[model samples]
Target: MTTDELKGLKVASLVDARGTACPGPLLAAKKAMGDIESGEILEVYSSDEGTKVDIPKWCQKMGHDYLGVVEESSYVRMFLKKS
Candidate 1:
């Protein structure tokens, strides 16, 4: 989804994993997912470049909906809807 579209979404939880690396951000997302209900949105912020690819792949493998990513100067925000 577009950044504007994602911005309009009601995120259920926000995981600010910025400053973390690789699996750190991914792990944070996994833990945060459990706090939200099914069909709810999770927004993950990460500075780790790996998260750009890792999160979407994780969502795909876990059967969650990988909405998209919004790039920022210091970090990128990824959106996912839990299945």
Candidate 2:
């Protein structure tokens, strides 16, 4: 998918993966993204430490855009733009 595919996309929902373990956050992100429009953003919140690397890597592998992260003391939220 091209960058244009991800343009004009607003957020659809947030997937909360707090307290979950490896791959859970990514899995939750997938489920959330499935409910959204093709160009929408799916925000994922996770307490898993792997998310710092996993989220962006998953996006790259799937042709999505990693919008960046929002960090809270308890969790990290990642934004992904579907492409």
Candidate 3:
């Protein structure tokens, strides 16, 4: 989806892993996913460039829906729906 579309979405959780490295953001997202219920959305914020690819791959492997991402000035907001 477009960044604007993602901005309008209501996520169940928001995990800010900005300023960290590759595995850091991914790990944060995995932990945060546990707090939300099935079918709920999880929004992850990260400045790590790898997250653009990592998050989608993680979602695919974990059986979740990879919605899309929204890029901000310094960070990107990634959306996923727990399955």
Candidate 4:
């Protein structure tokens, strides 16, 4: 989806991994998925450059819906749907 479309999403959970590196964001996203209901949207805020690729791959492997991302000044915001 477009950045504007993602911005308007109703996120069910948010994982902020801006302070951590590569796997941190992905791990947080994994954990956060347990907290939200199936089909709910999980938003991840990561400063790690690798998370952009890692998350989408993770989502694909995990059978979740990878909603795409939005890159801001310092962080990239990603969205995924729990499966």
Candidate 5:
């Protein structure tokens, strides 16, 4: 979805997982989900390359929806829709 469309959706937390390693982004994303409503989205920003793989796998294993990933100059943005 477009950034504007995503902006319309509720974001529980913008987890800045940048500079963190494996499991760190996932951990933060999971923690962020806890603070939001069930259907809300948790947006995660991470510099760790592992996030590209780990986040999706974690989402699958946890039964959450891995929306998509956006790449930026120095980091990547992962969008997760809580189920």
Candidate 6:
């Protein structure tokens, strides 16, 4: 989806992993996954630069649908659908 489309997603869960680093954001996404059902959307707010790559990779490895990301002034918003 486009960045605008990603920002408009109806998130089932939101994980504010901002200020956290590396595995922190990825771990939060993983942990938060348990709280959402299949097909639901999970929105992750992260500041770590690696998260821009980590999340999509994790989603791929875990078989989830990595929708897209929205870059903010100081952070990024990632969107994914549980599988």
Over 21-68, each residue of candidate 4 has an lDDT whose tens digit, in order, gives 868998999999999999899999999999998998999999999999
Per-model C-alpha RMSD: 0.6, 5.2, 0.7, 0.6, 1.9, 0.7
- On lDDT, who's better, 5 or 6? 6
Question: lDDT tens digits, residues 1-83, model 5?
Answer: 77556546666778998988887988888888888877778899999998899999988998888888778899988888888
Model 1, position 24, has a per-residue lDDT of 95
lDDT of 3 by residue, 32-72 (tens): 99999999999999999999999999999999999999889
TM-score of each: 0.97, 0.84, 0.96, 0.97, 0.85, 0.96
lDDT of 1 at 63: 100
Instruction: Report the lDDT tens digits of candidate 6 across residue range 3-73.
Output: 87887778999999998988899999999999999999999999999899888889999999999998899
RMSD in Å for model 4: 0.6
Against the reference, the lDDT scores of all candidates come to 0.93, 0.81, 0.94, 0.94, 0.84, 0.92
Residue 6 lDDT (model 3) = 89
Which of the two, 2 or 4, has more TM-score?
A: 4
Query: For candidate 6, which ten residues in a row score worst on lDDT?
Result: 2-11
lDDT of 4: 0.94
Q: What is the lDDT of candidate 6?
A: 0.92
Displacement of the residue 51 alpha carbon in candidate 2, Å? 1.0
For model 6, the stretches where C-alpha displacement exceeds 4 angstroms are none
